[model samples]
Target: MSVVTGCASCGDERAAGAAFCESCGRTLATGTPPAAGADCPACGTTDAVGADGYCGHCGRLVVRPRDHAETAVATVAAAVTDRGLRHHRNEDAMWLAARDADVDAVVCDGVSASFDPDIASEVAVEAAGRVLASGVPADSPGGLAARVGAAIAVAGAAVAALASTGDPRRAASNPACTIVAACVRGREIGYGWVGDSRAYWIPDEGDAEQLTEDDSWAAHAIGLGIDPRAAAVDPRAHAITAWLGADAGPVEPHTATLRPEQPGLLVLCSDGLWNYLSDPVEFAATVRGAVRKESDLLRAARALTALANERGGADNITVVLVPIN
Candidate 1:
């Protein structure tokens, strides 16, 4: 008998039942399927999140720690990372923590074409998350935006510093990844991004808005004059123009802030999830439906990932959902 296995992040071949993708450094599955009918953490309802980890009543994702790996900082914030159907492993990572009235979250996607991209993603998120958790700098002149930018700088440096640790091939190819992060305080939110990962403001009663613009070929073409639909279909559409790695030039991070009129969700995600539902209105509706049903932020994040998988799951998916009530 012969078996063939391919990476979930990249289409590289791998040994059967491998624990990690050799091409991308993403974690592989042991062939065990995820469990279903888990209880909803918010409503104490069984099978609320369903087999896919999404709650029907609240439309949130109840983490089934058994079925797949997931994490949550509090009722207000949650994140989920998964290796989709086509990928053998997940090359994405996220970190989030709620501190009093403030919330910090980071999401990173490993560049499939780069060496040890998974390592770059993991390191970047850790460095950024740590900076966010450490509290804002009091002496800093720029405040939240500056702090967010600083976090991205720290993340970039961390990735760049890793170039010397591995083999020569690693230094040559250089692990690379895209990152998006946010620090929210009450009604005010500060966000930053490098590469194509994204952040959005999803309101409870209004239209959703994409906060950070993508740093990719498609976005650049759209800026010049190309129609969005046309630009997105190009061969270089998803190719990230900026990232954190040894080869990446000076990291030109983008920063922004917003204050919503009503309560909503502050969402951060990788291309894997957004590619399936790019329309802000449609994405917001899907999220609003889930949040209304479960009121559990974690379940909401999981539901988003599930939606991506249902839409072909061509790559690893990651999402962080934080309630802004």
Candidate 2:
């Protein structure tokens, strides 16, 4: 067992067997325990310490899923969304649904500046995921572009509707979030995005390319002839100009399509994962390395999240991976 030398709250020297500060009654941030202690958070007893990170006394998890979570949609698709090391709670959300050769995925990042941003992300992701999973239009003239556009439109409407009642808590700022949704049907891929969440096509060889353009101030400035590195490192680099919310006038998603020559991986992720590895070449190499280490998409997803955290995860991290067969 590791010892906590001092209580950060009261600056009092900690005594053995004490879980909380004697002076302030504040719980100690004892860091992660190498072994499960006899003290159980739920039952407050020493007889229920389980090695599985759960309370044997009350069947409660000492660690919650909100801290970290993972989902495996299929053998070829998986995703991981994490609260990250610095964030208190995860505001990013992701959904992946696969049917035969079709894979639908959505990732939303809550705008921290807005009220109830987490709610916005959840609402937007769910709305978009539902629409995408409803199946593509087989005979529609719009094809993949129309399908993706429709899903994003529905998601924007869902977010806009949240302000109809106007909760007092959010009077200053309505809930807002950025979205990136995509559908992979056989070899064809269609993607759409609002704000900074991005989609990338990483092949087994050649180069990887970003599919969606960011709807942010920095990206806009770069489009106007600013230096790429200079624009990305500017103070307002992440100030998103487009988002889904009541205050946002309109949610217009930039859409794209890609048909890769070689089968590889399609990565849909929030900025949290790519912020650390913004270089396309480096990002592609890291992704390929992770895949080579673990063929399973679930494991590869975990590896990418782990890499983000290792590089100092300052934001909620979300990643969704779809393997092209």
Candidate 3:
């Protein structure tokens, strides 16, 4: 099988599975990730800002550690990095933490081409998380759809408003980004995403399959009869047709709930991390090893990043690891 290699952020082709691009220390095939943001969980009413990793209201830590007695231990790990191999600075950003999995998560990949792309990503992640936390109104079929539609429109509008504002990161044109968020509560799971960043759930015991498809030009080409292998090789594969921001053309998204109960590990990541670690078996092995090392959830996040970095830190890699028992 062909391996994954090259600078996902810059699109430099190289050896398959090669660690870092010889041209640059940048881990190839890995894309830029969103940066961490303030925790704005809806359920977290405590004065503790969820973003600070604690409960301001209760004056207690917000992130609950692994307590054998408190339900099954749910482990979450993640890391974000940007070296700006070519650019003056890295604009990618990411948020990975337990904001009440039941409440869901928010991930946004901003467009580096635009000014303050990082801020755009931050705005998107926070908006999605807050919306997911706020209770969706009680609705029937039409009501539910209409409510969701309105919420999405409002999200777009909110993003636009930020673009107009003069935040240090904001510019005449707002950066574009792609976001994917998933909510897991017990056996029930709901997911939503705008742009191409993805969400994947691979059973700890069963098979590994990607739950989301890329919204990239190459992915679209594959749907039109081109071979995925050839499509992958296309130089234009790097060209993302959609995302969030001023340059982002439209705002279409994917939303759904899992059928039958899903019991396994939940993986959410930016294109950077997924590009190099696409194999389901390998992905599972990495997570399992991290847990076995007696490492906490945070360690689990570091272990994976370490692996990528060891291989040759290529691109900005970011991941959220959630263990569902």
The TM-score leader among the candidates is 2
Please provide TM-scores, in order, for all candidate models, with all chains considered together. 0.78, 0.80, 0.65
The candidate, 2 or 3, that scores higher on lDDT is 2
Local accuracy by lDDT, each model: 0.76, 0.77, 0.54
Instruction: Please give, for residues 1-325, the per-residue lDDT of candidate 3 as tens digits.
Output: 0013443323457724554434322222233222224342544563445443454555544332110001112343333333312233334444332333332444566666677665666566555544544555434363333333444444555566676676655656676667777655555556666666777776756666577777788889999999988998899886777677754556776666653344666777766566666665776666667756946755666566566656665554456666665
lDDT of 1 by residue, 1-325 (tens): 0012554334457633564444433333322233466666668777665656567788775443322446565565777778777765567877655645567778899998988777788789878866776656633687777788889999999998888885888888888999999988888888999998999888877678999889999999999999999998899898888999989989978987787889888889999988888888887888788777877876777787888889899988888888788
Q: What TM-score does prediction 3 earn?
A: 0.65
lDDT of 1 at 196: 89
Give candidate 2's whole-model lDDT.
0.77
Alpha carbon RMSD to native, model 1: 12.2
- Candidate 1 off by > 4 Å: 1-68
**Could you tell me which 10 consecutive residues in candidate 3 have the lowest summed lDDT?**
64-73
For all the candidates, what are their Cα RMSDs to the real structure?
A: 12.2, 13.1, 15.9
Error of 1 at 50 (Å): 27
- Candidate 3 deviation (Cα RMSD): 15.9
